[model samples]
Target: MSSDDPLAAALAAAGLGGVQPGDTRPPEPRIEVVSDDPAEPTGPRELWPEGIGTGVGSLPGTDPREASALVTGETPEFPAFPELPARGVGADMIGRTAGLLVDLAVEVVPTGWRVTARTGRDLRRARDLLAGDLDAFDDACDRIRPHWVKIQVAGPWTLAASVELASGHRVLTDRGAVREFAASLGEGLRAHVAEVAERTGATVVVQLDEPGLPAVIAGSLSTASGYGTVRAVRAPDAQDLLRDLISGIAAPVVVHCCADRPPIRLLAGAGAAAVAIDATRPAFTGTTAEPRALDAIGETWDEGVPLLLGLLPGTAPEREPAIGDLARAGYDLADRLGFDRRRLARLAVPTPACGLAGATPDWARRALTLSRELGKAFADPDE
Candidate 1:
C-alpha cells in the first residue's frame, strides 16, 4: 500500500496502528457515562416535534445527491440521513457503521465482514462511501435548516452479530470483545453526532437500528460453520450495554427494531428517547399479536417514550392504501390497549415500515410523502 493513498493510510492506523497484520494492542480506555443513573429515555417528546415524519434511511439508488434531495424535499420538517446500499460493500448498514468505530476496522471477506490485522481496502471504501453520503446530505440541507435530523447506526448487538472476529466467529460470541466494541462504538458515534450537528446546524437524533437483535435474543442466528446456534444473549446484558451506550451519546437516542417481534420491553427499559417499530408488521397486528407485545406498547406509551411508528410500506404496493387504512394499525392498537387515540398525535412520528433501498424510485418518494401526510393526520385527525 502506497503512503500517498491517504484514505488507506488513515484507516490502517485505526485497524492496527499501521503495524503489519497480526499485531495487538489494548483498546483505549472504555468510555464512561456521565451518570450511572437509570437511563430513562431522557428525551422523546422534548426532542421531537409532535407528529413529524422521517425515513428509516436507505433509498433504492446509488446517487446520494438524489436520495438526499428526496428526503430533504419531501420530509423537510424532519429529514433522514440517506444511505444508498446499492453502492455496495462500504455503503451498506453494517459496513457504514464499521467506518465509525474508533480503533476497530472490518474488512469484507468472501464469507462476510471480518476483523482484520490491518486496515484493508474494504474498510477504506466503507469510510469513503459514508463520507460521500454525508457530504451529499450536508449539501442538500444547505438551504433549509431543520431543527432536527435523524441518523441511523447499527446497534451493538446487531454490529456484534454481523461482524466476524479474528477467530472466525461472530463478535457477540465473545463477551469481552462485545464490551470493547460497544465502548468504541459509543465514542465513535458521539464524535459523528458532533460533526453532523456542526455541519447541518441541527440537533442530531440517533436511531440505533437493531434488526438483528431479535435473532440474537432468540439465539436464532447461525454460527460461522452453520451447524450450531449462538447462545441467546440475556435480556439484562443487552439492556445494560445499550443503556451504557445511550447514556454516553449526549444526543437524544432512538432505538429502532423493525423485526416482527422487536423486544419492546427491553428497548423501552434501555433508556432510548424513542422506540421505532414497523407498525405494519404481523407481530404488532391486532389480536394475533402476543398479549405481552400489546402490553409492552401500552406501557411504552404510558411512560412517555415516543414511538416512531412505521405506518407506510417500504416498497410500494400494487394498490396504494388510504392514509386511514395505513394508520389503522396504530389506532386499533391504542383502542384495544385502552389508550386515547389522540395520544398518538403527541407521542408518535410517522415513517416507512423499513428502509426503501428495495423500493422503486417512485415508491420511495411516495412513501416519504405518505409519511408526511400521516404525520399531519396523526397530529390533526379531524382534518
Candidate 2:
C-alpha cells in the first residue's frame, strides 16, 4: 500500500506499517540485557577499555608524534589515534576517509573532495598523511605498550555525505555508490585495524564518526548548487550500510555522533558495540529531556550496550567543575531513567563532550585530564 493510503498511514502511526515487499528493514532488534552476573558468560567488558577515558579524536597540532605521545600519556588505557586536521586538505574528515577508499580516488576541490577517475596527487597525499600518522602512532606505542587502542574514521553515511561523486553530487545520492564505498571502507578498515594490532600489540577498537548523520537523515544537507536540500536517506538504508561496514571490521565498533538527536536505536541495531553521544549537549539538559533522546538512551542501556558519555567540555570552562559536578548530570540522568547509579560505572565511560581540535593546547590537555577524573568519579562517585 502507498504511504498516503489511509490504512497505511494509520498503520505507520501505530508503528506497524510502511514496510513494503522487499523492504530492507532489518529484523527488530532483541533488547535483552546481557547478564551482569559474573558467573554468566558475558561479553567483553572493556567497551571503553574499562576504567579509563579518552579523547574524541582530533587534537590541536601539526606534529603527529607529539599528538600521539600526548594521547598515550593522558589516556594510556584507551588512547585514540589523534587526528590533526590542521594539516589541511587531506587531514580533515572527508579527506581522511577518502584516503581509505580502495581503488577509488578523490581530489580536493573548492567544495570538498570529489571522486576522480584514477589515483592522483590529492589521493596519494591523503594516503601518505594517514600512513605517517599511523607510523607516529606506532612510535608512541613503542614507548607505552597500551593494552587497547582506538582509531576513528568517518562512518559510511557521513563519508557519503561529505564526499562527492564525479558529477559533484554527494555519494549518498546514489545507492550503488553508497554500497561500493561502504565495501571499500570495510576492506580498508580491516587492514587498518590489523596493522594497528600488529604494531601496538593491543586490541584495536574502531570508532565511526557520524557527526553529519542527523543532517543526512533529515535531508538538511545542501545540494551541489546550494539551491535545494539533498534527499534524506531512509533509516533502513543507512542502518544496512552501517551494519555491512561494521561486520567487515574485526574490532569492536563505536558509533560516535555528536548530533543533538543521534539515531541511537539505528546505530545499536546496526551492531555497534557501543554508541558515543554528548550527554552534556544542551538538548539533553534542563527541566525536561527530549523524550526521544531519553528513550533512546534507556533502550540502548537496556540492550546491555555501553555508552561513551561525553561528560567533559571539549574546551576548558571559565571555572572548571569538580569531578563530582561534572559527573552529577550523568548520575542524575541514570536516576531519572530509573537505573541504579552503579550502572553508570558498569555501562558508561566518560569522555570530552566532543573533539578538542578547536581548543587551545592547554585546554585540550586539561580536558583530557578531567575526562580521566570523570571516569574515576563514575567508578567511585563517593570518593
Candidate 3:
C-alpha cells in the first residue's frame, strides 16, 4: 500500500472496491492503527468514580424507568447516578476510557454503550479532551490510531427514544423535531470527526449508537409524559432522514445496535458503510436468535460492508472468553462462515460485547490491553 491512498487500500482489502448498494462484499481485510495525540489539556473532572451509574448522558429528558420498562421488561428508575459528582479534575475516566476504546476500534469485537459521556457536561468535557485525543492520534498515526478509528454519537432512534420534545411528546413522533435534532447531532459529530482527523490524519469510522431502533420501528417508544407509544414512521422516511443526518462527514458510517432488533436491512439500505452489532447481546448473536441477522451479516460482508462483531461477553471477566481465545474463536467462525481468515484479520476488532462502565476500572483496562494483544497475535499468527 502506498502512503497517499490508505482509503483505497482499505476498500480494496475489504473487497469493497467495486461493490455497490446491492452487492455484498467479502469479510474485512484491512488493519488500522490509531493516532496518538497526548498534548491536549485535560477536561473537567467527574463527580462519580467509574463503574457506578447508568453512564453519562443516558438520555437528556426522559424517565429511565419508562425506557427500561419498555426494553428490559422491568420497571426502571432514572439510571443516572445523581449521587456521583457529575463534574471536577484528576478524573482519569476519559483517558482510561480512551485506552479501552481505541484497542477495539477497527478490529471486530462486541463494543458499544458509551460511558465516556456520562453526563451532559461530559460531552463538553469530551470536546476538551479531544484536543489531547486528536493531538495524540495525529502525532502517532502509525502507532496509536486505528486504520479505522470508531467514533460514536447518540443515534436518531435512541435520541428519539431518550430525548423529549418541549411539548412532552417523544421526539420520534414529531418528524420535524427528530430532523432538527439529528441535524444538530450531525454538526457535533462532524466537529468530533474533524478533531480526530486533525489529531490522527487517518480514516475515522463514525458509529451511531442506537439502542432504541427496534422499538422505534415497532412503535413502542412512549411520549415524555408517558401517555402511550409513539407512532411508527415509514422506513423510507427514516432511512432518508438518517442519510441526511449523516451527510457532510467524509468517513464511512456504521450504525451500531447493542439492543435486539437492529434494523439491519434498513441500515444496510440506508447507505451506511457498515452495521455494527453487539454479538455479545443475545438480541444479535443468540443461539436461538433469528437467522436474518446472520444472513444480513453475511450479505453485508459480501457487499463489502464491514461488520464490527462483538463476540466478547458483556459481563465481567468471569463471563467472557479469555482475550486470546476470543480472537481465535472469532477467526474460526469467520472462516466457517465463508469469510477469508485474512479478511477476518482486518474486519474483526476484538472487544467486550458491550460497554464496560459496569465493570471495575481494572477489568476495563485489562479488557482493552487484551484486545490489542489479540489483534497483534491474529495479525502475525505465523509468529
Give the whole-model CA lDDT for all candidates, comma-separated.
Answer: 0.88, 0.87, 0.52
RMSD from true fold, candidate 3: 19.9
Question: Which regions in candidate 3 have their CA more than 4 angstroms from the true location?
Answer: 1-148, 283-286, 377-383
lDDT of 2 by residue, 1-383 (tens): 86578878876886768676466676788999888667957565455445668889998989999999889988888899999999998898888888888888889888888888998888888889999999999999889899889899999899989889989999989989988888899988888899999999999999999999999889999998999999998889789889888988888999999988889899999999899999887667766578778888999999989889998788768987887787888788888789987778767888888899888888888888878778777777666
Candidate 1, run of 10 with poorest lDDT: 15-24
Per lDDT, the best of the predicted structures is 1
Candidate 2 displacement at residue 163 in angstroms = 1.0
- Please, what are the lDDT tens digits per residue for candidate 3 over residues 1-383? 35467766676777667554466766767898877967789653211111111112121112323222221111011121111012222012222122222211111112212322233343444434444434433443434333334555667767655544444455577787666667666766676677766655445667676677778777877655566778887778778877886666676777777676677777877777767666655544436545676676677767666655665444455555565666666665566468867666455555455554454545544554455555555555454
Q: For model 1, how does the per-residue alpha-carbon lDDT over 209-286 read when each residue is reduced to its tens digit?
A: 999998998999888899999999988989999999999998989999999888888998999998999988766786
Worst 10 residues of 2 by lDDT: 42-51
Q: Which ten residues in a row have the lowest lDDT in candidate 3?
A: 75-84
Query: What TM-score does candidate 3 get on C-alpha atoms?
Result: 0.61
